[model samples]
Target: VESATRTAIEAIRTGIGTKPETEIADATEAEAPVREVISLLGIIDGAESDILVPDADDKCPGGYFHCNTTAQCVPQRANCDGSVDCDDASDEVNCVNEVDAKYWDHLYRKQPFGRHDNLRIGECLWPNENFSCPCRGDEILCRFQQLTDIPERLPQHDLATLDLTGNNFETIHETFFSELPDVDSLVLKFCSIREIASHAFDRLADNPLRTLYMDDNKLPHLPEHFFPEGNQLSILILARNHLHHLKRSDFLNLQKLQELDLRGNRIGNFEAEVFARLPNLEVLYLNENHLKRLDPDRFPRTLLNLHTLSLAYNQIEDIAANTFPFPRLRYLFLAGNRLSHIRDETFCNLSNLQGLHLNENRIEGFDLEAFACLKNLSSLLLTGNRFQTLDSRVLKNLTSLDYIYFSWFHLCSAAMNVRVCDPHGDGISSKLHLLDNQILRGS
Candidate 1:
């Protein structure tokens, strides 16, 4: 550049002397154009450039903007290029500062997200060309998209429901959805999830993520404190997974959790206090598992709000006395097992139970007062058992029985005033005259 400038200067000096008297004015007027050329060259020599190379340790060096909370740096040219170069995708946000104020007001008045009364599960429509997943109202559906990770370039809106069903997220890391704090329901069904970090949901403690469905996965067990304490998560479904066992610490301080479904797993026994911490739990389903017995001491007595519990289709051979100690229990499903005896006061604590299922078992005897305390039981199902003759006096106190189902007609007489008795007649007794069967009179 210096050599070129010197050559121009030398040529200008030669032109000044070589010019005639008439052309001297023209050469003098050209000096201003030569100075402009020199000024343009100075900009190219890094003397007035806007961008500067960076040295380490600074959040963002000169002319480079940092992606919020991350160490990544992007150039000024990439700021609002309609691309998501940041992990949290904060670069594209607030591109037009003047338009941001009006945009949020429009969003708040027109399409309010996380408002339960304004949202509905309906068909999805593509919002624009920028989104890969179709959205409707506050929901973003990405089902069957074959996505291995969450899409990076999503609209910066408060999402209420995010459905990623049929994806292949084998592991969920910590703070995976921290940026999407307003999501209320997350559906990851059939995601083949095998493991999750311990604090995967720690960042969602402040948000209102209520429902999480991770069914039909390959999760063997959950990490301790997988869900942080004091979260408002209500329903958790881990059904049909590879879960083998449970620990007491698996669920610690989920006070707002109402329902826990662990059906179709391989749980053999309940760990003490496994569910004692869930004070608001109402429904628990543990059916179709590998449980062999119901130990009275292992069952937690603190589940005062528990109303329905299903432990059917297990290998339970006997139920100890006071097996079900929940005071508010309304439905107890213990059918399809190998039970042979009904211990006295087994369901005494469950005085509010309305339905009791004890069918499809090998029961041959029952203590006289086995169901003495179940005065509110309305439906008693004891069919498919080996009891040929049941004592009538044993069930004479259950006056609230509206429906009683038994295998043999002789057992129907044990239910004195039941409105409906199944197996109407076996060539012996009819529903109208249950005592007509000679075997019932003999008992």
Candidate 2:
């Protein structure tokens, strides 16, 4: 290290190279700020600069790095990623793991995290009331902190993620975001939030807010326009909540939303336009709800880009023809329903589907034509259904049928008042498979 520092000192003393300002003026196009791809190959490429360091003349630069001995430089992001750019290896020493970069990034910006370590077990610190800052700018991790209310005066505005999970907050007030307006993601799962004030996120639409996770909350109902339109949000997670109803205007502003999760809710009814505003929605998780029926009118318009739809563990008794208007649907989960039969036209519209799960239903019979249009289907699960016979034409059009699982029965003895050789019932080893030759008959 001392030798390298002496060499640098000698290089500085002997005017063998041009000054740093002249090199900057000759290399770049008169300060056209290069946005991305800051490579440090100038070491071997023999460019004007030794490394991708910021020009010495540019004032108020965004980011830069400098070595201790050789005066070489690298980008700020290249510090802790298993590389030794400095002559003294200072950048790699005491480096935190990349996965835990959030913690170090906050510490680098002088945000507080461990100040309340001496506070009472269940207490919280209000903004500027305890420490100089309210929460960390990269993250507001108060998990398991037993917080009741979110304070009003946060110190930073450019928050990337605010996590308050496992707390005891019951409601979300409009003033909750009065200070932290630029938070991109908010996670409040297991916080017991029952109600969010209308317009709680008033000015967040103009910010970069994208994902909102409120799973495992106590919200029984949400007001209309919960998130304003043109918000550019992509994912919304409300799973394991007590939500029971949905209106058309519930998502008027979430046109760019891609995934919506309402699993384990009590929603039994919704308007035809429930998903009308989400044109780019690709994944919809409605499993474990109280849905009773599905029809074409239930979806007023087609979801052209929808790829996965889950309605499992519902009370679905009837599925109308053309129920799902998604032409790009690849996976459909209807298992654990109460359907007794699948009509011939029920699944005729799902031509692009690859997997269909009807397992654990009370289904007694289904027309082979219902599956004829599913030319691309590879997996069909009908396990645990009471099937007395299987149609010979079931596998005729299943050109891409790669897997089929169904329970087979042999005899229904009136004397025993029970089914005898049911494969799934009596654990009997069958001589011939039920899904191989198409026609299934009992003894």
Candidate 3:
């Protein structure tokens, strides 16, 4: 810059002896090129320039160049027709957006560049050339943002859905979303969240916040009274976390909760009366855990609305009778456990049960009248067990059963001497009994 200024000064001095007006115009035009060179150099080097316009000309001083020459302070929106805004038209510079364009190219592999730009999914929409949508807070998506901290300046008023998935947030500190009071559907899944403070969701009290998804995080436990009074969150997904146990007060204020998913965790125990407050819960997923027993106190009479309960892939060896108090249950999954027997009254209350899964267990005894109350039962899976008998009377009253799986139904009925059914006659029953012709296919 010093060398260029000296060279321009030398040229001005050479024209000092010319006529006054002509000499001044030539020097003025020569100085214009020098200043333009410096401005262009700042753009090329990616540095903040000290260039200034008259305060009167810059209506929005130190603010974004929002449409045309009007300098209004708003959220940054750099996409443009890319021609001119200022007298020198500096706003038109750097229109390529190469840095962000290349970032998407690297993350979305096996796909062409710019494949994910401005895509819309359901109510969520990725930002396009127009920074924010016309429907501002109705659906705001900041997914894959790589943000490490929560921004205190988030939009608060009348916000309904906020999708912050695939970020870098490790913990949810207190008052993190206090500014966003009206946000209803808060989705923070696929983040690195290890801890969540007691009042992390207090801002959602003013609205009918219905869904809270914190799946695929590292959360080990939730604080007592996680939500305040009158909070109406219905869906809570905590799958694939590090949770070991659930305490009673962990869900104290959630009375209207309908669906609770705790699958793929290390959960070993549920405290007595842990779900006493969840009177309206419907679908409960306790699958893929380490629970050996389910306490009856957890399913108080308050759970009259409970319908589906999944306890598959656990280590439960015995179930205390009357453990499942949800009389309206339609689906009961006890498959992939260590159960060796089904008590005579184990399923007496499940009159509405449609699908009963006891497959892949150690159960050998089958009481025919045990499932007499389940007149709506349609599917019963008992594959991969140690049942050595083929008594047709045991399954006689299953009027609603269509697809029933056993060790090998047709083979066991035709010949208990079949190697796969009894392996040897040592376990008893080389006798064969047949009551039907069709074999259950692909059981």
Evaluate model 2: give its lDDT. Answer: 0.64
Candidate with the larger TM-score of 1 and 3: 1
Alpha carbon deviation, residue 328, candidate 1 (Å): 0.5
Note the residue pairs that clash in candidate 2. Answer: 229-253
Q: Tell me which residue pairs clash in candidate 1.
A: none
In model 3, what lDDT does residue 443 have? 14
lDDT of 2 by residue, 132-186 (tens): 2234434556677787765444435556666667888787787666565566777
Which of the two, 1 or 3, has more lDDT? 1
lDDT of 3 by residue, 1-443 (tens): 64444444445546543345565565446555444533532322222222333356554332233334444322122222333434545445544433223223322223111233354443333334243322232566667778776544445455566667788888788867655546667778889898888877776666678988888899899875478877879988888899998988888778889988888899998765788778889988888899997655546677788887888888999887677877898788888999988766677678887778887999888665656677777666677888767565555556565445566433234221111222211221211111011121111
TM-score of each: 0.67, 0.61, 0.61
On residues 1-443, what C-alpha lDDT tens digit does candidate 1 reach at each position? 64444344445556542445445454335444534533532223322223333358655653356677676766443455466666678766765433113222322222123333344544433344456677766677778898878876554547767878899889887857666636778888899899988888787678778988888899999888778766789988888898888988888868888988887888887786889898899988887789998878867888999988888888999888887879998888887899999977788888898888898999998888888888988778888999889887778668777567788754655664554455533543222122223343342
Q: Backbone clash tally for model 3? A: 0
Weakest ten-residue segment in model 2 by summed lDDT: 412-421
Which regions of candidate 3 are displaced past 4 Å?
Answer: 1-138, 151-160, 411-443
**Best candidate according to TM-score:** 1
- In order, the Cα lDDT scores of the candidates are 0.71, 0.64, 0.62
